[model samples]
Target: MTDWAAFTGFTGLVLVVLLSFAYVSRGVPHGDGASVSFDDNPDRETSLDGSRNDVELDGDELVSAATTENVVDGVSSTPIVPTPDSAAVSSDLPTHLLIANVAVSQALLGAFLALGAWYAEIPSAALGISAGDVPTKLGVGLALGLGLYAANRVGSSLSRQFGFTPDEALRESLTPESRAGWVLLLFVALPLIAGFEELLFRGALVGAVAVGFDVSPWLMAAVSSAAFGAGHSAQGRLGIVVTGLLGFVLAAAFVLTQSLLVVVVAHYLVNALEFVGNELFGW
Candidate 1:
């Protein structure tokens, strides 16, 4: 039988070195290299389709071309007012679905990693709907949450520094009902999902790799986090960067919390606040 333990340790160490090198290299100045930042502004550019011009201009509103809002002036003096071209709507609809597929792909990649570890006989490779070490598991979940949020801040800062707007994920559709569905999907899905992720990635993988290889715990954590980031490729370049940053945060959390207690709490709290806005209402 393959010494799965030894193999994992070796893999973890290799990943640590690779990711560390990449992380450091990012700081090195390449000739003519410029940093791009995230533009919180959703409407910085005009659509080439002249969609904005057609929109009922209310004092020349600078609109993002991505918006589905009707651009033709409702009160045009012309006998036949121009309507938003069907082509524009058709082109945009596909793009929206494409972005969503990307996000889903990243998430699935993470799941694949967990399954791989299980096949290798790695303990704690994944958290079953029920798993050992309940308190520890919860702590890990919290760590994942805070780690992700911190990663988000770092990635946004990097985006701003680089002067690039990360591609926004295409929303499925613009509808009150769809929006509500999305909210339910995330709020209802994320807590359990997040918990499972932490258990598998931070708790199991990190711990197994660390023990298997007899490497430094910190190194093991770092390697797992890098894998976490890479798994998020479907999120696009920006998503990968964000995942990488969060991976670092999770690594730190695992190391510090040691029991996964605080990690889960932190994770749950961050998700609730960021997505559900429950924290804002003191929930």
Candidate 2:
């Protein structure tokens, strides 16, 4: 039998973390305008009006594509102006520092969760860390991530139609200047975010909660997905709703696969693709 005391502790902890994140993120500027985008070139970033930022990059730093009008399919179009959060890294937090800070925060949070689970006598397998076929799981994860991203694109378009603009400020604010920053984002921060979020939101919130209460995982998913949305409230209302839907999908996947790795990989790809799509494809 599961320990209700330990379960309650986990529930409380999750609630506090989600609420805190939602609170802090509300301070970040939300973009009502369209999202910032760059081209396939590593050197290009975004800002429009064909002007360089006042703050100069050192040495071989990546140049931006935002400040100029670029021709796509024979039509000259300028990128959307970034919100205050990314208008200048100088006034706000620098991009690299922000990425590093997030990486550190995720690491610390993951450690805490791990320790708590151990103390609660929760096995790793119960948390969706079973010995499974790695290759097949990864392939499945990749496909799911790609598929979800496509759905996300459609959802975003529909949200815009409904006059609910999806905020892209957080993503814009994380735009990197140096190659090192990209490395940190792709290798460290993204993986940590994926692992920690899936572990907490799906593995614990949906899977473990159902097992402990002998309740339907779908009911747990509904409850947990709300918290997932709350945690992303910095992204604004449309984002919160969209993210909540995405969370439910992932939660369902976790219920079906019983593997955190699947969701982790899928989650990582969704984020990574968003960054890449904007930076490289201007999508």
Candidate 3:
């Protein structure tokens, strides 16, 4: 068993999982609906206490119920404009089912990679398992993750501005709408995705391959980063480019620090914050 063997096995596993995911996602509906926003929320109302659900006075008594539309002083303030006719939101896809599928696939692939690496007897350091400046790595990773997330938002906006409105169909389709589903996303799905992707792309693809082949880590970073971007084809063409650039940055970080932990933390925060921001602020 050698580092090359581990890398080869890992790439094979990744190809299998990615191909399977692409095949399985063929039926996912494209998002014809525009991004949901606060202005679209019909239930919001302005009152003496500020904003909240609609409050109305009837016979000297205030009545309150879940609002169907915004109303004030015998007038309908917000019309319930319907969602787009072609919107995927009309479909009955379950977010939990999507999350479960992703979690299981990543978990299986990660487990296999781990087993292969262990059998290959790859040095722990080569695999980025050493306890190197734990606090600094964590801190920098967190900051990097936050910065990347902000940059991601800006990049997406710029893409849209340039007549390349990103097809967020895949993201919208997988978005969880319930508390329980959100819990699963933040705690289970996100961490696994970040960890497994960082392990495969940065650790094995860049680190191990570079070390074993006596190749420049930067070269491996480009190769691995390209694959990383292709792995996210579900996000559409623009998404592929954006994700690839982001992947290159992560790969470079791995090459520089030689610590997968930093990239993992950064990746996790980027994804976690993306979901949280979308769910809360509809960003």
Model 2 C-alpha lDDT per residue in residues 118-205, reported as the tens digit of each score: 7777766667788779898898899999998887766666655654545555687776788999998889888988887888888887
Alpha carbon lDDT of each predicted model: 0.43, 0.66, 0.65
**Counted clashes in each candidate structure:** 26, 9, 0
How do the residues 145-242 of candidate 3 rate in per-residue lDDT, one tens digit apiece? Answer: 88888877776566555544445455555567788998887899788888888888889888887787788999989988888766665454445556
The full ranking of all candidates by TM-score, starting with the best, is 2, 3, 1
- Segments in model 1 whose C-alpha atoms lie over 4 Å from true places: 1-163, 170-184, 261-272, 277-283
Ranking by lDDT: 2, 3, 1
Error of 1 at 99 (Å): 13
| Highest lDDT model number | 2
Q: Estimated TM-score per prediction?
A: 0.46, 0.76, 0.74
Worst 10 residues of 3 by lDDT: 75-84
TM-score of 3: 0.74
